[model samples]
Target: MEKFSTHTGIAVPLRQSNVDTDQIIPAVYLKRITKTGFDDALFASWRKNDDFVLNREPYRQGSVLVAGPDFGTGSSREHAVWALRDYGFKVVISSRFADIFRGNSGKQGLLAAQVEQSDVELIWKRIEEEPGTEVTVDLESRTVTVGSLTVPFQIDDYTRWRLTEGLDDIGLTLQHEEDISAYEARRPAWLPRTLPART
Candidate 1:
């Protein structure tokens, strides 16, 4: 999990609403347990149409996905986050997001920014009108800017801190591994033990 700071990059406008987890990465691609290769499978069905925004060359390399409301609205797969991250997206901005998807995204160090629908529309238009348009998201200031538009958003202090530090759930737990091991060692023997029956 790389630490996030101010990011300025090309914005890919995915104007469709209610983009579910399946669309983000179809179920067919879920056969693999490894998180390394899902990038190729992202928006698989949509890309097959050759008319989707992601299929367009200008937005192909974009890292910030500016999408419609209810982005990541279905399912609870953490793979959605992995697919996005592996595909080089660091932030996903939308008017709304499903609670579970948002939680999963945060755990993986992806910024799920909630901005007004109107602001989202503005970004959508900007990208369409100017394919080379660049946007910047500043996690530190909790703001997103594109052209003349600047939108302020709210993220919990802890989430923001984690993003800035690039600490995922595993990273956070690893920070206290020593203490956690010590506490576990002090546990009562009656605690359901899995240690090879003390051979």
Candidate 2:
């Protein structure tokens, strides 16, 4: 996964709140095995309207999503994060997020920034008024900035460290590679074997 110290891009204002995992990529689209290529499936229902926020210009290319409170509120699906990432979103801003969804996002390297509801509305107003304005999300600074306005966002210290360091679950595990290798070398052959044991 890529490091997420700071990301600046066009911000898409998703006015609706309580956006669930199903609304993100629907269960029908989960058939694909790969982590990517789900871009087309993202917001499948909403995108059909042509008037959906994401279907609009500049927003179609946006990498930062500023959504209302209670975002990612439904089922726990890592695919939801995958869909957002595949759709080119590097960060998602919301006042509140479901616990499971937030966890999935962190593991996938998607920065889920929790800002106050008032700040979220302010962000929406800025983006909606300018329509294509770029917003900067600085993880290191723990702030989201649009034009002259800047608002703080909160993320756990551990997650912030992991994201800023570009460490995912697999990356975290690999940090102890030498220790794991050494331990495995000391294990008895009788413990287990991929290949069948000789009779």
Q: What is the Cα-based lDDT of residue 167 in candidate 1? A: 77
Q: Model 2 misses residue 67 by how many Å?
A: 0.8
Candidate 1 per-residue lDDT, tens place, 82-105, comes to 999899888899999899998888
- Measured by lDDT, the strongest candidate is 2
Tell me model 1's lDDT, rounded to 2 decimals: 0.87
Q: For candidate 2, give the lDDT.
A: 0.92
> How far out, in Å, is residue 19 in model 1?
0.5
Q: For candidate 2, lDDT tens digit of each residue in 36-129?
A: 8888988999999989998789788999999888889888878899999999999999999999999999888999999999999999999999
Q: Report, for all candidates in order, the number of backbone clashes.
A: 0, 0
Number of the predicted model whose TM-score against the real structure is largest: 2
Worst 10 residues of 2 by lDDT: 190-199
At residue 67, candidate 2 shows an lDDT of 87
